[model samples]
Target: MWQPLKEKIKIHWPLLALAGVSALSVGMVVALLETVGVLNLAPADSAIVESELAPEAPSAVLGLADRPPAQRTEALSLIAQQQDNQEGHRARYLLATDLLSQGRGGSALTVLDGLEQDYEALAPYVLLKRAQAQTAAGQPEAAQQTWQTLAEQYAQHPAAAEALYTLGQSDESTWEQLIANFPAHPRSVEVAAKQLPVATGAKQMALLRLLVNYGLHQSEYGTWLDQFVSEYGSLLTPEDWQAAGFGYWETQRYGKAGSAYAKAPASPLSRYRAGRGAQLDGQRKAAIAAYRQLAQAFPDAPETATGLLKLADLLPQPEAIKVLDQVMARFPNQAATALGKRADRLDALQSPTSAQQARDAVLSQYSQSEAAAELRFRQAQQQAKAGHYESALSWAQQLLKDNSTHQLAPEVGFLAGKWALQLEQPEVAQRAFERVIGQHPESYFAWRSAVYLGWDVGDFDGVRSLDPQIVLPDQRTPPPAGSDTLKELYLLGQDQDAWTQWQNEFRDRESPSVAEQFTDGLMRIGVGDTLDGIFMVSNLAWREQPQARQEYLALQADPAYWQAMYPFPYEQLIETWSRQRQLNPLLVTALIRQESRFVADIESVAGALGLMQVMPGTADWIEAQIGQTGYDLTQPADNVELGTWYLDYTHREYDNNALFAVASYNAGPGNVADWIQRGGFTDADDFVRQIPFAETQGYVEAVFGGYWNYLRLYNPAIAAKVERLAATQPNS
Candidate 1:
């Protein structure tokens, strides 16, 4: 959703309030002026200015957490004084929370009073807190009444679930009601954990459903699922069997899922999952039979096409090719991928001629298909990799000519432009780049094309001076699919409400449409589950579903699509660190986005911590060099400060080239130095291409791609300039 320009416009107040200035002593006024960057007499003053200003603009919600207790108290006091807006309510809430933590329950209750109507999204939470404060203040009867009111009014909210659990602590009747009314709530898991011991039949099944659907990934749920299957397998109904199968699937118990799904084979999805689960569980014969049955029974179903493709992969050579041919004939739009796989096998079998023949068939038969475009682009890549620039250029040109509207067309044009440069065809390269700019102005590669055309969009040294403007429309159009109410809730920033509504509405977990999955991802992100949301949305790029692909294509043109994909979670930390290090903030943001996906507390398996994924040893070295101490690497500000220092060090080591610095950041300075020596590559693009480590190569592309996306989506000036470039480019 597009925020109003008023919201986007930030007004930075001086650190010292004007009202207090007159009362302050002369020394205090000078100190305050120095703190706010008003004193510009010396280099030391600049350093002091940065240190004082950096922490002042932390993330709106998370900044309070980063502040010291004293600062937090002062901040909240200021906000509470202006109690007339959202910030005021937020401040009161935080102040109450802090007071409660300090055992000032009466004070907390005073702060929370009358905030119910003003904070509808957090009303249930306010009530829950009020109840807790009541209990702490020795008003147990009042607390109980508040809890009852909460449960009755906000039954679907997680706060209500917590309230019910609290009420259930002394009342078994409340516990039973909790289980009956909120079977899918997280608190119901606690109820089931207690009741499952003596439960039987329908009660047992219901408990299992609650555990499977809402419970955390724990061994106890696995144990309960196993027990339920063993005790009631023979007597369960079809729906129960299906539910059990879904439960098993959720837990990754593939073999058990297959068995449960086998009992409910009437559903096409169940049949497909039965096959997939059996295959994953190493029951090859059962998997084969299940897939065959699904394809035979549901010949016209979409799952049938997928079933045949899976069946092809499991079968022998000629038989595999025969099955692929059937898919190609029946599902032509899907055939290019099928044909490409078949071609790979042919090449692996020492039949290059047959491989070429298969690829040729796809191009000749389905030249306008997305598969054809993909196959041609891949062929261009293969030719380029083999040093046959002319042949690669030919394939790329033909791909654009034949599949102009295909998703990969811009990619082909970009590659063609790169190949033209390699082949010393500047005119051809310019035309190709122009075509990419004109035809796919929204793509990252279009930005690349713009840069190559000598637009001052920004580079490593010059980005600091570039004032990229981001233009957002007054309103954002909702996604083409999903419940209107859920969309509205999301737009209003009521993520919990949207998530709860989505959980109730989202059925057919076995086979969701692309739009459903994308919406699910959005809801997941809204609820602070960034990694799962990223996986759900990013995985759609490779989806074979025609409708899903179309939906994805449609979304690509929207700025919100990119923003959702590449969110700037820790803006203050990244900006502070980047500015301190004299680096491009967008570039730092790109690296952090790649490293941690904005998960502040995430640690890689290699022990890298926080937003920048700084390793402990590296942090120690950086600390020693900078004379900084007592820094927690798991903290966002500290991690980014150290990471940017390391990044700046790398850039200086490489004479300020971002390509080498980014590569070094991933593979380490030693490996990157060795690669530079061996490859003797001077051009940044050439250096990137010749990097031996595939992971490092991909990382560079992803980081830079993130940078381009940030510029296009967030910076209005750069976005407008690029749009103008696209408009001026010759259409042909």
Candidate 2:
């Protein structure tokens, strides 16, 4: 049996901390991901694997490699016995992988014999594996010859880099060849990692530049950039400055990014970002200069229009008003936003007549703009607060008519439904709720609407114990981008190879296509990068380009996109604990996602740790109550056990009302108790609105929102219901 290994990649680069970086491949093992090169394999001892290995419908012979290793072992071996077809070719290659993993090199060699002649998609990898088999079989000379053969024959391929890396183990010269030929490959990344600590001067800077170019600059990039600036600033080029600035910006080093961008090439985007970065970093003087330069140099550029708007923030009142006037006159697309700002400034100066003119112009000229929608929403909220539901309903209705696809449409529509109910109009309220469910099923409001309309999904009050059934996808979806080889490697559970191939191919870090970005997100999720993966997928709504946004809208219609956004990382543990506590597993999953984005060992700044982000003090207290000790907080099993126990306690305190229980989890029971006494509201929804703590309110909604998403995406019955609602016309 080829058991899975539990070992870290030799050189770990903390994946893009802001968003792009992620630990790699999640199917059958926790393998090295992102910029790290996977150089060696270790024997496994029953390591974790996800559901992609579940049996699939039969058809393609190549897909047999996707089945679970143990389950498919016999089938693959028997298939390997046939030597004439592509199925046999793939079977032999796969069988060799298990053999190599188990250190049965002689057997692996026997199966891999002549595989390069038959396996065209992975011929280079076939050769590379053969070298490993030779070494494992104690035939060092054979391995050396095989490595040299692979490196020479497929010098242009990614596998050639691996061959060079293996050969470089004894001969120091092959490292340079690997670096020269496959600079973006993870193995080349390893070469830089090996040489960086000892190398300095031009050599050190070269290595850093190499790493940065490969998008290998992860969490420590900011520190590296700082060193490059302080010690080797003279060596920097416009491109170098741009790379450093990008790394600094992504890692939240705003101050450094601002300075670097100022020195970078004079692109419209760079100039605008320099000012924005400076503004964010609190350098008002630098920001003003940068923005002023942008206004003068690229007056026609869209980024400059945005830059001028930002510039208004730092300018004096009179100067800001002048800037806004200029923006409104010059940029029609940005005119509404600029006019709204102008109105606010006029109002501040007590010029009501002028302010009213600007406000009217916004509605008359740019009715569909975001600023107009905001204005309408503010009025609706004001009217509702004043208990004039008729006026509120009118404003909400108008806003939806004008800005149906606005970011705030879901909230506004839901508010309209509530206001209609307040006005004693049951039909209007039901219509509003249905429209929200139909048009914005992905929104938090949709879940609230579903509950109000009496969907079977358990409500906040009773969701604690419902055992909703869910069905996991049997296999990974074929990625929308990447070569056929990359897709095959990924879907077949060859995660390590797929990760390396992906990193090598994906060089569009700054701007990527919808397909590329979606593919990137899928790869991240496949490898257990819950945070990076979800962020990449969910933020597609913010796409600004027209075509990209259209593509995103189309992508939204796919169930796989929603599924990728809400994945099941620890299903078994969640189920066991939820059953023990008589709680909903989906609720637990949602809570974990909100708490830590399902990063098993993540720790919060407040000393909360692990999947549930349980406080160490809370863990200690729970241990005292449960009569258990010597548990690690970073481990998923212990953390979920303790976290679920605490969750159960909170649910009991709140009579299993999930809203109050989830609130208590974040805000503490004392604050929740205080709220119940102090809160003066009509019902649970009203209570949520009146919650004093903004963070707590957001946290509560986020958890429940997450719960709703998980339920809809995973539970077939709910998924069908939501899909039906989404497909309906607004009124229908």
Candidate 3:
């Protein structure tokens, strides 16, 4: 529904990131910052899952496992002693792991003794930990024997891969077994790395292929794949090329991907990718030829349409018109855009008559299309820029007559209303504002309309203090894909193990099923990988294939997608600090998600650090004012406390106006002060459009849009209001 708007405007919400940070000191700090949350062993809502075991199981996950391991070991031990039932398994395992990690392995061994027999479902993990405990306890022989037993007995288990990896540290042949049996195991990456320098022939190719296929999309894998192509290009099969091409493509080595895709299996997609990659790689002639070949070979395929458009971009005005003419004739769905592009080409060719005819054809025949809407929108903007309010209103109304439900309609309606106010037409402005709030309650424009139309949603200045009720889900959405055991592991808060198991199962990295990708995203978030997690989940929107897009739509029909996209990370810190600063918690959370995506120690290009992206200079100023010292910006608590205090300061600077404060946060005070002083805006929304900086303009919308999503997704009352408003509108 919002697809057209996506091309015309930045939606700003559901911006999922594919998150992974390398093991820098900062990475360790992020882990430490998020580990307590990652523990998932803390007190949780009773409704964490729904099952026969939901009562005991969720508590089982929480009863003894909810606290940080180091802080709550003895408490877990006491709980384990109290309950030797099924729940004791979790308690004991937690106790044992704590003991092992803290180097009291003998104590861990006593706790873990015979746990394999009792906890049959987690027997492999038990055995693996037992071996680790043995090694840590200086029982080298016992550890060796235990590793051998695990490798020999549970060789098929994912945990057994770890055992084999450990044993292979001393024996090369054991790694060979690991490579042969568990190619997808993460340990295989290690095995490949360990043996890569010494390997040759099929053995060497096999290691490279393993890394290429399941190297976790690391940067080095791109270099390795390049070498593999260099040495064994002739020996590689089409399937190998497909994998290699995907690796190169993911790494943005478009030239390599173009080369690899040329050798991959002949298909519309491969051909399109080959051309597209070539285009991006700046091999213009190759790209043009590939695109032309694709259009000829797969005339009816969707890729041909995309390829043709790209092909036209490489051609001159005259030649581009011909390609666009072909698109107009062949693909009715794309004909509007084709006509619009052709009009520009015709104008560039100085054939004004032909250009007007082309544009008129679009407005008359494809009036409802995104192209027509955008064309009309441009006209409106041109008139508005020229101070022709009446003409601008006419064009915006014409745009809405065709596309009232489009993503841009809300913005247009709001603009029309604002323009009406400029023209002193109060009734027309009120009706236009009503249309925006009625049709697109989720949009930022609706929030503006609500404030102008006198709804109680709060305004730019008042929104910061309005503490809307927040609601957490009764239970997390069940996994859309993966094994029951995978679900079990996830539900139990066994984050590391679950992620490892998921990695072993999720082999179709290049072309994942929607459910698989969504599951992948959820697991990533489970392990404090919010950037990647949100990315994997939210990127489902880009699926182009019919089945994939259908699956994506089905997944999105549920509330799960939105919830996961706007997850409540670092809530404890956000709420505590927000209360401390007398700011809205949701607003703080929105800013944090926008700033660092809940990555505790993330540093931006501008040297802003931590969850709120506070600059060192600002932090120093804040410290001097508050008389606090020695606060690390990388720490979540420290960052939030400082950031919220600054947020408060910014609010005070603008007389408690959130709009000005959020703008100040991104563009800094000097720019904001300048914008405010030079403002000719009618209201806050108009003020946004007048902001000279595109990034700051978008930042204001993004931050507020993020805030609205949090409120809509987490606040039941506001959600019901949005739904009620949407229900009254025909195509909202």
lDDT of 1 by residue, 269-309 (tens): 88888999999999888988999998888877777778888
Candidates 1 and 2, the one with greater TM-score: 2
Estimate, for each residue in 8-86, the C-alpha lDDT of model 3 and write its tens digit: 2211111111011122342343333233222222121223211124322334334334345654554444335444444
Q: Native-vs-model 2 lDDT?
A: 0.79
**Candidate 2 per-residue lDDT over residues 532-598, each given as its tens digit:** 8788888788887689988998898887788888888888899998898888999999999999988
Shift of residue 316 alpha carbon in model 1, Å: 2.5
State the C-alpha lDDT per candidate: 0.72, 0.79, 0.79
Ranking by lDDT: 2, 3, 1
- TM-score per prediction, in order, is 0.74, 0.88, 0.80
| Local distance difference test, candidate 3 | 0.79
Residue pairs whose backbone atoms clash in candidate 2: 3-44, 4-44, 5-44, 16-21, 24-33, 26-527
User: Model 1, stretches more than 4 Å misplaced?
Assistant: 1-140, 153-162, 190-206, 216-266, 277-286, 340-355, 382-391, 404-408, 421-428, 434-444, 459-516, 542-551, 554-556, 623-632, 680-682, 724-732
Model with the higher lDDT, candidate 1 or 2: 2
The prediction achieving the highest TM-score against the true structure is 2
lDDT for position 702 in model 2: 89
